[model samples]
Target: MVITVPATVPIESFQRLRIETYTDVAAAALLVYDYLLTFNVEKSLIWPSRWNIMKVLFLLTRYLPFVDVTLVLFYQLKTNISVETCRATYFPAGWFIVLGIMVAEIILTIRTWAIWGRSKRIGIILGVSALVAIIPTLYIEKVFLDSLVFSPYPSPATPGCLLTAGNPIIAASFVIVILFETLVLTLTLIKGVQHYRIASGRGFVSVLYRDGVVFYIYLFGISVVNLIVIVAAPRDLANLLAIFQRVMHSLLSARVLMNLREANQREYALAGMQSSPLQHLSFSQSRSSEEDRLSFRRNLDGTVIDIS
Candidate 1:
């Protein structure tokens, strides 16, 4: 059975869909702007560190959704576009979204790695798993792009690029993404619990538990809504929901990066301050009682014993 959207939808319904799409895109853009301006200081993020580099990369991902929306709006306004041209224009939008999601997922994986004591094995395993998960999304994207279909809107006034009559397999792509996101979030929570147990709720460890859980829940919630909209919502509203999802991905990914960095900094700063007063307590050890040498060592947790 070949499912097809009607070439001529009711005029009012189409207009409503258009309005909803506009509103959703506008809201997403505003959110990205708000997060960037509120939390990210340009000078602060310019530092040369692994976290800062990743923060810069993550910040760059925020524009993908906006750029995709701009292309969509441009195509909508054009009067002389062929079906092939329109299809070509919309093709990159899917890949752009996939790229944005992939970048965000990478940041999540990095956070998980950090929470796992930056173990090479754990990072490698998570990285490989994430890469494996991406294969299906890419495959589905190819299928969707190959089987792409387009039909004109109901109104003559808004005649340009045709609206997409979405494919079933295309919707299934989001399921793969959501599954991978769940996997990452689960690993994060597990690592967080283990760390809390081992460290006895040490300084700034709560950042992982609190921010990690909250951010994952929020992103997962958005992913669930995105999948639901793709699978069950009316076709007109599906794309709008997707737009919202990408925007939130960009916003929250950046916020997570910022939060984790701040948490790590605060932890180190506090540890340094606490250890400052003990720095002068140098102990001397003599091998044969003729000469003494001073040894300097610092332990911030106050658990180490000085046998000398």
Candidate 2:
């Protein structure tokens, strides 16, 4: 028995598609990059410092692949390419995103360990989940390779990669992940709200309020809609879903970047490092003795600070 595969898109068609996809990736990646660039390390009200840095790295690794996958999917839709073609091309591109998620899981798992402190029960719950839930799910995606197109009409036009877990596995996996994400997000929201209530001073609540609730609500909504679209109107909503997924991906990532920056800022503030010259004047008032003051006129790298 012989299996047929996607023919390469016509060079002209592929080039045009490539450019279009490239343009899309460029726009998408830039949104993430700009968010990173503009992100001030003083925004995320509930940052885990080391974890946030890992998140920054995770974002850098993950988002590009997402952009690449977006571009590949765009080409597939535009050129009427095969799903196999989409799978083959997107597989490599998606690796980075998967890698990022893996890293995030690791980083977050550790944080959960810390947050789940003194509770061997929840820690073990998360540990078992990391092994049981995330690992096997990743392995299952491998089935996409060597998978066939299950479409009834055997035509090259309706090209796409078909895998074994179409209805059953796909449905199950999506449900589990969505459910898990909902629970985790809920847990995070509860913790964040409590922290906000206990917080003192002005501007504290505002930071959490900024992206905290809005962003999670957005993510949770996206996950639900994504599952709904995948199950109910997979083909009908391709164009719209692609755009929505891309935007949602950007929003989720941008929040992580912003949160990382905010976490760092809080550490500085807590450490008494984020001080003003006026505050320094108050310190110098009582202890006006010899060698009591130090000059901060140096504009060198470490000497310079941005209070803004």
Candidate 3:
């Protein structure tokens, strides 16, 4: 069955679907991150000290949920809701929703880095950058909108609705942000690798650090590496708009699952030690030492009798 959006949508059309959906995703990401922090996922992999990193991610992503949701609402309003942009005939135009998804992707990427690499400093930096960058985007987008003649959704395709500067300044700002993110991701990879080497040095100590870093490095190698290409991503290149968010969602979920499994495995190991091997060792050593004491006591008694 084919779905179709209406040709004439109310002003709040963008706010309805895109913003609401993006909010759902971003809010969920923030919630999962909080749950992980509350559960001490970082402490499981690194130390309790690392919980601060996850805490920062949770807070920052919580802020970003609004960014995505607001933009999604903006897009639905801006969108014609015609067959051109909305994926279906009567529903949302996916192409134009790229703007909202891009915001979402960047936010999600921040959480992903914090989770995998234990990155607090980077999260703080990115959060600040995003705040500053939004000022310019808002000013630029608004001024550009003012010069337009027709209200959006005046007709099918909405192609002639208005003329807006696909502002290069706004585009350049995102590129700079992406470049900053790339740098942060690179630093995380280096740290994770260093931690991995340290963990390997500990003789029989199970994969506390080694596995943590391995997962981080794997995420970087697989997803972060691809993101480097997007640092120079073009403004009108609408196709790449959704690329970052969709990719981060997949990678973030994967790492979270792996970290959860490792934590459970560690708990099982600790539990097994408490129940079996540790108990046996304590019992055997106690029995052996008691027997030796009894023998020595008998020997002392014999010596005293001989002296008598």
Candidate 4:
């Protein structure tokens, strides 16, 4: 039974789709460029570090996009892809994006958790708020994906899938993202104010605060644009910024980890150089004791700086 549906997508939608393909490629290119630029820092600073939860998160946020964007580009650019194949790809691709965003948020949440002196109460609050935001957003995405109606390609030469229409309810997901980011930014600002009131000058804590605020703002702005497009633009333009948002989340979160690690290493090196000769001699004589001492100090500093 051949079920034929009329072509409903306009020429303008195809033009927008072409632009979207370019955007995805650009996002992927940026990911590769960033990786090359930071490869040395990652090797020197991250590789030697012991295996930990944060290391796992950093690697996921860093490398998962390679696989994601590859799949996305293939789905978008592959010629003669069947409608069924295109439909099948939507669920995994959408979930992959949601997964990336969630992991990045976890990194931010942990950072927020640390800045509050690792208070269990604060941790619980953040954890619960994340869940509240995430649950509804996921539900909305699932509903939107399930409701999507794909139009058949006008010709066999068509390179990608086309959407007949988009559900405006998808905008809800970005609204939730903006709200959650607002909560995270508010928490960071409150903590920053408290930290600066006591501390006279900038230090590692300042770095965490600065990055948190800046990244949150960036993510917030992107989410706003995404929401506006989904609500105000044509159905074809609804997802124009989705790939960019995911890439930014991965890029910025990876930077947060790398910058924190590098700063910690520099602080440790400076502290070591300033030690007295007698102290150095003592440390040299008891290498094992020094290792333990340094390890404890690293953990303490990591906690203060929200490395986890």
Candidate 5:
């Protein structure tokens, strides 16, 4: 009896797979490091805080990536994985990435809505826009996953799954993401400018705006790069940035929530130190209507603050 062994993958293909594996490993490692760095903040500011919708969303955005990243690392690092196993694992991994991004976007949407005084009109608009962007993007993602062409492992020793072709239509999902982010950023900037003009100090509102803008910039750049890689790169090299972008969505969105909570804690502490009724009166009088609407007030436990 004669047996055949598959030929080794070409050097170029092996190199690309190596690079992709490195990216997956980097993303997983970064998430762990970030979790450690922020664990103290989470304990102090988040764990003790009253549970609200924002808190729930923050927790979801903060920790859900562990599951997604684990799946990704498995898919990328498991040697001798079958093509059937790859097909079964890959879509779930993709869905996890999408779910992570969607949850983070929800957190940002709520933040934007809060900065805008939680106006019902603005909330309605954001909600509608999110639905519009999300539903189609999800459908496109399903189509993209369905269109993937996975090849047999180039060699028995080849690490991880191999994709020989993919639908560039996946690029459309990133385009939608970029467009939605633009809208969110525009709203944030307009409110930020208003806050800058009226607010006298770097208060909670300032922290919210600053973080929102910075987060937008980083996520926007990543989304663009992901789109470009999908559209222009070879199928083997496509999706190189997908996991990184999802990790950023989780990491940055978590930061935005934590920073806002921390700023609220500081302002609450500072306000408590002031004893003069006259000073309070003067400060209240000086605030514009918009500033008043954006004011932060702490809960009885002093662990949570909300823009009222």
Candidate 6:
């Protein structure tokens, strides 16, 4: 097979690539530093819990890409490497990025499941939706891999994967993720609001409302920004935005999970402390002629239903 070598990029494109490399390195360093600082607090608690496991995976997914990309950059900096080898690196790097995003999305789906009071139906629906979304994503990944070609004359500084040959499919892939996330976030909000009516004063419910909204806003805003940047910005600049998007996904997803766990722990502790000879509020669903009704059952022991 004849090798199709990519042409050297323009000076401006080379500069953009340099900036992307530097920024990615800085972001990765910051993520590592933050993870280490909190290691003592989270180390024992992370692996055993299912939620924590997903969070850990999300973090790894983010970190691994940085390592892979850094190595590719360094390899490009060296001389005498075959174009094929350098071009080959993009496949795995891209896969890492796609896998990380999928993991993050799964975490969000789980969070939505819990927010919906562990409804099996909601979980199933979201699961199916996620599977459908992955089909198109995998197609996009293939397109990206097939498009990978290194510049024929490698620049001294930037000699990695060049802009993918024109492909609208790659540009539109972000929308699939954005729509899926928006659906998850909307479901979460709906469930939260419904539960909030009855569980408004409860600590766990309040935590959900506070943290869940913030999480959705952060991810949603960035996804929109990423989509726009990919479509509108020059390819080199678009690449930077894409990397930064993954960084934010790692940071925010992990942050929200950690905060929720901490809040749950605190609520559990406070409930234990405040146990008194008060009546426990037990909720019951009643069917009436017009609609369903909610009734509370009182218990002799002073424990309220521990929502946390």
Please give, for residues 163-206, the per-residue lDDT of candidate 3 as tens digits: 21232333443454455445545554564465444333321112
lDDT of 2 by residue, 1-308 (tens): 22332344334433443444454465466656755665453233323334334445445534554555555555445435655565566566445444544553444344333322325776676667767767665665455333434222144554333321232233344455565556555555664565445443223223433444455566567657767765675332322333344455554544543553454355356436326555544332222211111111111012111112
How close is each model in CA RMSD to the real structure? 8.8, 10.3, 17.0, 6.0, 5.2, 7.0
Q: Give the candidate order by descending lDDT.
A: 5, 4, 1, 6, 2, 3
Residue 17 lDDT in candidate 6 = 67
| Higher-scoring candidate on TM-score, 1 or 2 | 1
Tell me which residue pairs clash in candidate 4: none
**TM-score comparison, 2 vs 6, better candidate:** 6
User: Please, what are the lDDT tens digits per residue for candidate 6 over residues 17-54?
Assistant: 67777766675676677678666546554544544355
TM-score: the better of candidates 1 and 3 = 1
Give candidate 6's error at residue 132 in angstroms: 1.5
Local distance difference test, per candidate?
Answer: 0.63, 0.44, 0.39, 0.77, 0.79, 0.61
* TM-scores for all predictions: 0.76, 0.56, 0.39, 0.87, 0.88, 0.77
* lDDT tens digits by residue: candidate 5, 174-210: 9999999999999999988877777754666678789
Better of 4 and 6 by TM-score: 4
How displaced is residue 151 in candidate 6, in Å?
1.4
Predicted structure 1, TM vs. truth: 0.76
Model 2's TM-score against the true structure: 0.56
Q: What lDDT would candidate 2 get against the real structure?
A: 0.44
